[model samples]
Each structure stands twice: as C-alpha cells, then as structure tokens.
Target: MSKVVLITGASSGIGKSIAIFLTEKGYNVYGTSRNPKNIESFPFKLIALDVLKVDTINDAVNFIIKQEGKLDILINNAGMGITGPIEDTPTDEMRAVFNTNLFGAIDVMKAVLPQMRQQKSGVIVNVTSIAGYMGLPFRGLYSATKGALETITEATSMEVKPFGIKVVCVAPGDFATNIAAGRYHTPVFENSAYKENYQMNLDLMDAHVSEGMDPIEMAKAVHRIIETKNPKIHYKLGGFLEKFSIVLKRILPDRVYEKMLMNHYKL
Candidate 1:
C-alpha cells in the first residue's frame, strides 16, 4: 500500500498543493477541511473537520485509518491570519486566533500521536511561518500564533523522538496563496489609538500578499521533507531575504526596527 498521508487545511494554499504533489507521487492522500463538501474530487478521501474541535480531529484520523489501514504522515496546516495593530486588536480576536492556530494544531497532534506511536514510525510537519521566528509590523497576533507552534513543536519533537516519530516545524516566508489573496477580517473598532494605523497596515499587508512568493514553492519543500528518511527540527525555507531578515532581527535594536517599519509603511 502507498504510504497514507493526511493533511489538515488541505483545501487551499500550501495544504492543497502538498496534497496534489503527494498524491501524484503515489501516497494515498487524505485531506481534512472545515468544509469537506466543497472540496474538489480527488483520488484521496475528504472529511469534514474543524481543527478547533478536538472531536473533528479524531474523526478525521479515524476516517483515514479505516480507509488506508495505517497513517504515515500528518501535516498540521489549517489556520487563519489575524492581522491588525496590536493595541487595536480585541481580546476576543487574540483568543480566537490562538484557538485556531496553536490550540487547533495541538488537538490534531494529540489525535494522531496514538496511531503513530503504535506504528512506531510517522512524520509530522507543522505549517509554521516566518512570523514564528521574527515579528512583522501589525501582525503581532499572527506572529504570536505561529511562534507558539514553533515552541510547541520543539518540545514535542524531543518527547516523540523516543517513539520513533519525526516532527518538523516548517516555517515559510511570504508565499503567494489565498491566505494573502486578500484581507477579509477588518475590524470596525470605534475611536481607538491605532485605528488609522491599523487600516494603513492592513493595506500594506494586502500589498505584501499581492507581491509574495508562490504557494507552490512551499508545498514542494513539504513533500521533500515527508519523503526524506529523516527530517530536521525546523526548516526555514524560501527566498534568501527570509534568512537575512531573521539575521537582521537579531542585530537590530527594538526601537530601531520599529522605526524602520513605521518609515517603510509611512505610518
């Protein structure tokens, strides 16, 4: 039997591309999305799943195991971006963002670990982001969410290594995907300290997406890691600038970087 690979957030962007690439390579791919009915027809199975709900994670796994008889890989990729100025971002928004990014990924990881443990071999790739390593202007929440996953994956790797499981937190830089296709969650906050600043940043972020790297570029990296005999703790992939940005973040002072962002965006 072809290795069974299950991908969460498989509807679009990096998730969908990975599914297609892996499927073409002969892995029996199972994709989970909050809206399973809308998924296009494919050789693999599609199951309804909301990673925020632990039960949904369970069902997705069970469905795959029943069909494939074994699970070889789990790619936690379902998440959303919460973009706005940090001060203007509502408390509820922060909770909701983490609920989806950090908590949701954790639920899926817990759900799949049992099966993977029993088999004593499996590959887990958490779809983290460049935000995890360094902060982005007006993207504090999004950065925080991915950052949480980065830390979680680190501790998780050590615990699961003894069980013969390989865990990877793959952080991608800007990728041209529907995620950056547009910014939809605009907040209509009443008079606030950061209202105008927030709008300007949103516009800038949207502009960034319009000029980002292709999402397929990220998918290819994911496929390579899954196929490899062993994967690294973290894979920071993409254009050379991504690496340089992290390096700059280390040397630059806090306010110096803040001024750079403000000046670039003309905030």
Candidate 2:
C-alpha cells in the first residue's frame, strides 16, 4: 500500500506545494485548512482543520487514520507571523501568534504521535524558519515561536528515535508565499517609542520574503527528506546567502552578528 501523509496549513504557500509534490510521487496525501471551503480543487483530499483547536486537530487525524489505516508522515507547517516592537506588542496578540505557530503544531503532533509510535515507522517534519536562528528587531515574537518549535523538534527526535519514529525540522530561509498577506501586524501606537524604525523594519522583512526562494524548491527539499530512510534532525533550505547567514551567525561573535543584522535592515 502507498504511504499516507498528512500536512497542516496545506491550503496554500509551501504547504500547498508540498501536498501537490508528494501526491505526484504517489503518496496518499491529505491536506488541511481552517476552512476547507477556501482551498481550491486538488487531486488529494482537503480536510477542514484548525490547528489551534484541539478537537478539529483530532478529527482530522482520526479521519485520515480511518481511511488509510496508517499514517506514514505528518508535516506540521501551520504557522503565523507577528511584526512589531516587542514592548508595544500586546500580550494577547503574542499568545495568539504562539498558539498558531507553536501550540497548534504541538496539538497536531500529539494527535498523530500515538499512531506513529504504534506503527514504529513514521516521520514527523516540522516546518520552521531561518528567522528562528536569530531574533529580528520587529519580528521578535515570530522568531521566538519558531525557535521554540525548533528546540522541541530536537528533543522529540531523540525521544522518538528508539520507537523508529524520526522527527525532523525543515528550516526555510524565506519562501515566496502568501504568508505576508495573512501575517499579523501589531498596532503601532502613535508617538510610540519604536515608531521610527518599526515600519522600515517591517517593510524590509516583507520585501525579503517576497523575493525569497520558490515554494516548489522548498517542497522538493522536503520530498527528498521524506524519501530518506533516516533523515537528519534538521534540514536548512534556502539560497546561498540565506544558508551562509545561518553558518555565519553561528561562527561570528555575538556583537558582530548583531551589527550585521542591524546593518542589513538599515537599523
């Protein structure tokens, strides 16, 4: 029987690309969106799933397992971005962003893990970001969420290895996707302390994402990882600059890296 794969946030962007790519490879793929109605037609199935809601997450997993009898892969790609100064960002807004980016992914992981554990042969890939490697000025909260997920992915990989379940994190630098369209821009209070640089930083970030690597490129990398019998714990996907940036951040002194990032954003 063909392997069954479940992908969250597959309505568009990288998620959509991965779903279509895997299906072409002959995997039985089921994708998800908060509102399935919004998803356009595709060869694979589309299931209504709001990762933030525990019940819907469970329902989606249950439906897939019921139909396929086994799930071979789970890709946690549902995430949201929040942009603003850390001080001015409201607590509720931060929580909502974390809920979608961090907690929501965890919810789906919890739902699918049991079956994966039982099968003793499955893969779980969490879609993280290169932003997770460093804290950007206006995107601090978004960075924190991905960083947290990356840490979790590391821990989960070790814990589940003995059970034959491989947990990996695919960190992409920037993908040309509609993510910016749905991203949350925290309200910048007039005369606020960060007003001067906040908009500039936000605009720069948006422009970088718009010009980032193609979503299909990211999907192809993921497909390669999925085919590997034992993929590495972390896979970084991006162009030369993006990939080198991560390495430079690791090797450079703290102050130097900070200055590099600040200079890049013209801060």
Candidate 3:
C-alpha cells in the first residue's frame, strides 16, 4: 500500500503544492485547511483543521486514522507570516503568530505521535523557512517562530527515534506564493519612527517572493526526505545566496554577520 500522508495548511502555497505532488505520486494524501469547505475543489481530499484549535487538530487526525488505519507521514506545513518593526508590531500579534507557528505545529505533532508510535514507523516533516536560520529586518517575528520550531524538531527527533518515527525540518527560502497576501503586515504609520525603512523593507520582501523559485522545489525536497532511510535533522532549500547566508552566519563573527544582513536589507 502507498504511504498515507497528512499535510496541514494545504489550501494554497507550498502546502498545496506538496499535497498535490504527493497525491500524484500515488501516496494517500489528506490536506488540511482552516476552512476546507471554502475550497470547492482540490486534487486530494481537503479536511477542516485549524492548527490553533486543539479540538480541530485532534478531530482531523482521528478522522484520518479511521480512514487510513495508519498515517505514514505528516507534513506539518501550517504556518502564518508576520512582518513589522519590533517596536511597532503589537505584542498580541506576536503571541498570535507564535501560537500558530510554534505552539500550533507542536499540537499537531502531539496529536500524531501516539498513532505513529503504534505504527512503529513514520515520518514527520516540519516545513520551516530559510529565514529561520537568521533574523531578518521587519520579519523578525516570522523568523523567531520558525527558528523555535527548528529547535523543537531537533528535540522531538531524538525522543521519537526509539519508536522508529522520524522528525525533521525542511526550511524553504522565499517561494512564489500567496503568503504575502496572508501575512499580517503592520501598517506604515506616517509618524512612526520606522515608517520609511519599514515600508521599503516590506516592498523588498514582496518583490523577493514574486521573483522566488517555484513552490514545486519545496514539494520535491519533501518527497525526497520522506523516501530517505535515515533523513538528516534538517534540510534547507533556496537559491545559492540564501543557503550561503546560513553558512556565512556560521563562519562570520556575530557583529560581522549582523552587519552583512543590515547591508543586504539596506538597513
């Protein structure tokens, strides 16, 4: 039998691309969305699953287990984006993003682990971002959330290894997606101190997304990870500069790396 796969936040963007690709590859795929009903058509089954709600997460996971007997893979792709100056961004909004990106992803993993442990074999891929490796101007909250998830993935991987379950992170660079549309962008207040620089960085971010690589690359990477016998703890996919930036951070002094990022963002 083909491996049964579950992907969260599959209504569009990278998650949708992965769901469709896996389905075509003959995997039994179930994609989740906060409002799966809103989407009239999808290549694979779309189920209602809001990551913020534990009830919804449990319900969706249970429903999948009932239908498939076992879930062989989980693509924890559900996440939201936030962008603004640290001072201007609301603390409440920061908590909300953390809830969805870090806590929310953790909840889904908790819901799946029992069943995966029972099966004695499974793969869980947490879809993080290349930004997770380094903080970016205006996108600090988004980076922090993904970075937290990366650390969690490392801890969980070791814990679940005894059960023959694998947990890994796939961090993708900017992809051409509707993520910008869904992102919570703090408005550019005319009197705000960061008004000019914040707005400029926001535009730069959108342009990067528009010119980003296809989401299919992420799909391909996830597919490869699921098939690997002993997958690495982390896998990063992005353009040469994006991937190289991570390396640069490792080799460069703290202030030097910070300066390089400032220069890149024209901060």
Candidate 4:
C-alpha cells in the first residue's frame, strides 16, 4: 500500500500545496482545517482539526488510523503568524501562538506515536520558519514560537529514533500565501515607542511575503525529505540570503550579525 500521510493546516498555503502534491504522488493523504465544512472541496481528504484543541487532534488521528490501518507520515504544518514589537504584542496573543505552534504540534505527535511505535516505523515533519533562527525586528513572537519547535524537533528525533521513527523540521522562508490575512497584527499604536519602525518593518515583511517563492517549492522539498533513507534533523527551504543568514550567524560575531539585521530592516 502507498504511505498514509496526515497534514495539518491544509485548507490553504504551504500545507495545501504539500497535501495536493503528495496526493498526486499516490500517497493516501489526509489534510486538516479548523473548519472543514468551510472548504467546499479538496483534492484529498480534508478533515476538521483545530490544533489548539487536543480533543480534535486525538479524534483526527484516531479517525485516520481506523481508515488506513497505519499512518506512515505526519506533516505537522499547522501554525499562525504574529507581528509587533515584543513589548506591544499582547502577552495572551504570544501564549496563543505558542499553544498552537509548539504545544499543539507536540500533542499531535503524542497522539500518533503509539500507533507509529506499534507499527515500528513512522516519520514526523514539523514545518517551522526560517525566521525562527533569528530575532527579527517586529516578528519576535512568531520567531520564538518556531524557534522553540525547532529545538523540540531535535530532542524528539533522538528520543524516537530507537522506536524506528523519524522526526524532522523543515523551516521555510516567505512563501506566497494568505498567512498575512490570518496573522494577528498588534495595531500600530500612534503613541507606541516602536510606532514608526514597527510600521515600516511590517510593510517590509508584507512585501517580502507577496514576492515570495511558490509554495510548490516547499512541497517539493518535503517530498524529497520524505523519500530519503536517513533525513537530517533540520532542513531549510528559502532564498539564498535567507538560508545564508543562518550560516552567517554561526560564523559572525554577535554584534556584527545584529548590525546586519538592523541595517536590513533599517532600524
């Protein structure tokens, strides 16, 4: 039988691209949405699953196992974006993103591990962000969420290896998606200390997303990783500069890298 796959946040954007691509490749793909009823149709199976809700996560995982007998791959792609100066960003909102991006992803992995463990094999790919590797000016909350997930993936991969399971993190740079529409934007308050610079950085961020590479490229990258015999713990998919920035950070002095980012954002 073809590999059974589950992908979260598949109503649109990168998750949708990956689901469709994998379905076309003959994998038994099950994509998820917070409101599956809202989506009239999808190329593969689209189910209701809100990552913030552990019950929904468990139900979805159980439903898949019942239908497929076994799940071979899981693409933990559900996440949201938040942008604002760290001080201006609401504490509750920061916690909300963490719940969805980090805790929720972990919960899903927990739900699947038993079945995967019993089967003696499985692969979990967590979709992170290139922004996670650095503290971007107005996107500190978003960066932190993905960054935390990256670390979790590293630890989880080692823990599950003996179970014949694989865990990987695929961090993508800006991709032309409707993420901006869904992001929680802390309003640009006129009296706020970061008003001018924050607004400028927000505009710059939107422009970058609008001009970003195709989501299909991300799908292709995931496909390649899934097919590998021994995939690396972390993989980054982005433009040359975006990926290189991580490398530069490793080799450059602290102040030097900070200066480069400040110059890039004109802060």
Candidate 5:
C-alpha cells in the first residue's frame, strides 16, 4: 500500500508543490482546498474543505479514513498572513488570521489523531515561519500566529510521543509564493502606537518576500521530513540570509539584535 498523507491548503504554492511531488513519489496524497472540485483533475484526490469549518474538516477526514483505511502523514500547511502593527490590527481580523493559521491546524490535528493513535504511528508537520521564533516590527500579529503554532507543535510532540506520533515544525523564510500578495494589508491604525516607526519595517517585509526563497525549497524540505523515520522536532530552511538571521537572533543580545535588524533592513 502506498503511504497515505493528507495536506491542507493544497491548491497552490508550497502545498500544491508538495502534493505534486509526493504524488509523483508514490504517496497516496489527498489534497484539501476551499474549492477542491475546481482543481484540475490529477492523480491525487481533491477534498473540498475550508479549514475554518469544523464540520468540513471532520467530513474530509472521515472520507480519507474510509478510503485510505489509516492516515500516516498530515501536513498542516493551511495558513493565512496579515501585515500590520499588532497594536493597530483589529480584533476581528486577528481572530480571522488565527482561525485559519492556528485554530485550523489544531482542528485537523484533532481530527486525525485518533487513527494515528490506533495505528501507533504518524507524523504531523506545521509549516511555520522564521518569524515564529523571532518577532519583527509591523508584523507582530502575523508572527504571533506562527509562534503559537511552533509552541503547540512542541507541546503536542511531547504529549503524543508516547503514542508513537511525531509532530514537526518547519519554519521556512520568505518563500516565493502568493502569501505576499495574499497578505491582508489592512490600514490597521488610525491612532496607534508605534505609528511613526512602522514605515521602514513594512518596507523591509515587502522587500524580503519579493526576493526570498522559492516555494520548491519549502516543498523539498517537506519531502525530506516525510521520508525520515524520525524527523527532528523543528526544521528551518531558506537561503543564506534567513539561516543567518536565525543564527544571529540566537547569538546577539536583545539590544544588539534590534540594532542589527534596524541596520539590516535600514529601519
């Protein structure tokens, strides 16, 4: 039997690439999207789902369980990004982002855990970002979602370890994807704190995505994780710059890192 895996947010970008690659590699991949039927016909099955919908998530998992008999891998790749200062980002919008990014990952994980527990083996990967570990200005809330995901991954990994389940977090930096264009860039403030300091930070984020990692880089990383018998707790990948940023953030003092960020992004 081919290994059965389910991926969310599989309509495009890294998710789409991973689906295509894994399918070619003989995994029985089931890809979920908001408009699954609209997707062009392919070898893998398309599942109609909105990650935010609890019933939709349940139905999709049930369908997979019936067809595949057991679920072996789950790629919690569905997420949304928003760009704005944390203070100014509206409450509703914050939940909206969290709904798809954090809550949705949890929803799917909950739905899939039973089968994995029964089988006594499985792997779950959450595609977080470098910002998940280190915060940056003008993207406080967006970073918060990924940070929460990384935390849940850590906690969940330890909790599920006894069940022979592995949870992995992948923090890739600035992949070439529609996430930049899809970013919800609301005029998040009328009278907000740090209003004056946000200009350069926003510009830095824009430039970083415009010329950063390719989506395939992320897809390849996903492939590597899936093939491993025991994947690491966390994986970080991207170009030289993103890896260096992660390292420097670890070594440099808080004030020193702040200064380096200001200098690097010219803030």
Candidate 6:
C-alpha cells in the first residue's frame, strides 16, 4: 500500500509544491488550506483546514485516518511572515504569527501523534526558515516563531523516538513563491525611530525572498527526507551562501556575525 502523507498550508508556495511533488511520486497526499476552495486544480485532495483552529485540524486528520487507515507522514508547513522591529511590532500582531507558525504547528502535531504512536512508525517534518537560526533586521518576530519551532522539533524528536516517529525540521532560505503577497508589513509610524532603517530592511527582505531558490528544490528536499529511513533531526535546504551563513554564525564571533548581518541588510 502507498504511504499516506498530509501537509498543511497547501494552498500555495512550498507546501503546495511539496504536496504536488509527493503526489506525483505515488504517495497518497492530502493538502490543507484555510479555504479548500482557494486550491484550484490540485492533483491531490484539498482538505479545508485552518491550522489555528483545533477543531478543523482534528477534522482534517480524522478524515485522512478514515480514508487511509494510517498517516505515514506529516509536513507541518503552514506559516506566515511579518516585518517590523521587535518594539514596533504590536503584541497582537506577534501573537497572530505565532498562532499559525508555532502553536498551530504544535497543535497539528499533537492531533497526529496518537495514531503514529499507535502504529509505531511515522515521519513528521516541520518547515522552518534560515531566519530561525539567525535574527533578521525587520523580521525579528518571524525569526522567533521559526526558532521556537526548531527547538520544539528537537524536543519532540527526543520524546517521540521510542514510538518510532521521526521529527525533523527543514529550514529553507528564501524561495520564489507568493509568500511576499501574504506577508504582513507592520505599520510604520511617521515619527517612529525605526522608520528609515525598518523600511529599507523590509524592502530588501522582500526582494531577496522574491528572487530566492526554487520551490521545487525545497519539495525535493522533503521528498528525500520522507524516503530516507533514518533522516537527521534537522535539514537545511537552500543556496551555498545561505547554508554557509549558518555555519559562520556558529563559528564566528557574536560581534562579527552582527556586523555581517548589519552589512547585508544595510542596517
């Protein structure tokens, strides 16, 4: 029997690409979006799901369980990005990002684990970002969400290993996708201190994301992660410079890393 896989935020971008790629490879794929109607002409089934809502998550999983008998893989890829300084970002706005990026991912993982535990085998992949490892200029909150998810993914792997469930984090650098269209640009105040630098950094960040790696590359990384029996706890998928930056951050001094970031972002 073909393995059953479920992915969240499947309306577009990396999530959508992964779903299509996996489906073409003969995995029984189910993708989720807040509105199933938005996913037009998808190869796999589009399940209505709002990751922030527990009931919708449960319903989506239950539907999959009923149809496939077991969920062999799950990609917690639903997330959003926001741009603003830490102080300039409103508490409610920060919560909204975390709601979908962190809490929502965890909630879905919770909903799916029982079955994986029962079956004694499953793969859970969380789509994080390169920003998770290093703080970005105006996208601090977005970085925080991904960073938190990465840590959670680590902890989850340790806890669930006995059940034969593998939890992995795939941190992709920028990719060519509609993510910028959905990105929340925090309101800039006329007299705000961070107005100039914030605007400059935000524009640069948007441009980088628009011209970054292909989404198919990320999809292929997910494919490899699922196919491998013993996948690593974390996988960084992106360009050479992007992946190199992670290594630099670990080896370089704090001040040097800070300077590199400031120069790159023109902060």
lDDT of each: 0.83, 0.91, 0.95, 0.96, 0.86, 0.93
Backbone collisions counted per model: 1, 0, 0, 0, 0, 0
Off by over 4 Å in 6: none
- Residue-by-residue lDDT tens digits, candidate 4, 22-115: 9999999999999999787988999989988889999999999999899999999999999999989889999999999999999999999999
Name the runs in model 3 displaced over 4 angstroms. Answer: none
1-267 per-residue lDDT for model 5 (tens digits): 888999998988889888888998889999999987677876778898788999999999999999879999999999988878776778899899999899999999999999999999999999898888777767777789999999999999999999999999999888777787777875735576665566656666777787877787778889999889888998998778777888888888999989987776566
lDDT of 1 by residue, 177-198 (tens): 8885433364747777777777
Model 2: how large is the Cα RMSD against the reference? Answer: 1.0
Candidate 6 local lDDT, 1-267, one digit each (tens) = 999999999889999999999999999999998989854879999998898899999999999999889999999999998988888888999899999999999999999999999999999999999899988888889899999999999999999999999999999998999898898888888988999998888778778888898999999999999999899999998889999999999999999999998998887
Runs in model 2 deviating more than 4 A are none
2 or 3, greater by TM-score: 3
Estimate TM-scores for all models.
0.93, 0.98, 0.99, 0.99, 0.93, 0.98
Per-residue lDDT of model 2, residues 141-231, tens digit only = 9999999999999998888889899999999988889899988998767888888789888788788889988999988999999999879
Q: Whose TM-score is higher: candidate 5's or candidate 6's?
A: 6
TM-score of 5: 0.93
Ranking by lDDT: 4, 3, 6, 2, 5, 1
- How much RMSD separates candidate 1 from the native structure? 1.9
